[model samples]
Target: MSTAEAGRGPRLVPVRAADGRVGWSLVAANGRRLAAAVRSYRSDRELASGICELLAERAVLRFVLSQREDRLWIWTAHLPARSTRAGAGGGEAVARSARGYLRRDQCRQSVAAFRQGADHVQRLRRLAGGAFPSSAW
Candidate 1:
């Protein structure tokens, strides 16, 4: 069940892998996972700071949806490179959908939900086990 169905609101969850790598996942109100950090942080402190950085740059962050060679759709949120940096390519992807979608519309819906949840985030928590919330699966 989604968070809403489970009597919870959407929230950002900070997680730590068994290897001590940290990352964040955006969980939707319905309990579905929208997106997660593309790369893991070295520590919880770094994960927290990275989240702060993303929030500071959120206004300028860009969202893109694309199809993989496997024919699955995915979305990514990135920070565009400075225009003055001629050698720079596209911005680096910071977060991506937690899983691929079978259709473009499904991917777009996830992105839309991600935007809403992210903009109005009310709670942030780390699961007791430091893993993605089982409810999110």
Candidate 2:
């Protein structure tokens, strides 16, 4: 999964799977809308993490969707600063910067977990053929 800037929004494009299926997600900054599409998932968790990774890179905000032990979290990074507020006190701004970026870390961890889960489910489905239920993920 990778993110590419598209117009005013961000476009997320994923590589086609072995079954010739592609998934995509798009989000506009300023909290406009969220769009997602999924095709074939030979395994339940095939592209779980991928979706999150794409969103994290392009989103200014994200929504998480998961079930039971299988969790999927989504996040968007802040858009580039368009302006700097004057008289905001540079000292305070500097202090805030020292806090580091918690949001970025959260997004990264969520994507990693989702990726791991997807890989596990994919292997299970492949081994079990069509015996595994789609809801198992």
TM-score of model number 1: 0.76
Model 2 agreement with the true structure over 17-80: per-residue lDDT tens digits: 6776655433323332233343433443556554433333332223333232334334322223
Query: Candidate 1: how many backbone clashes?
Result: 4
Tell me the whole-model lDDT of each prediction, alpha carbons only.
Answer: 0.73, 0.35
Q: For model 1, what is the error of residue 90's alpha carbon versus the real structure, in angstroms, after optimal superposition?
A: 2.5
lDDT score, candidate 1, position 5: 46
Lowest-sum lDDT 10-residue window in model 2: 91-100
TM-score of model 2 (CA atoms): 0.27
Report the lDDT of model 1 for residue 69. Answer: 94
Task: Quote the lDDT for 46 in model 1.
Answer: 81
Each prediction's TM-score versus the true structure: 0.76, 0.27
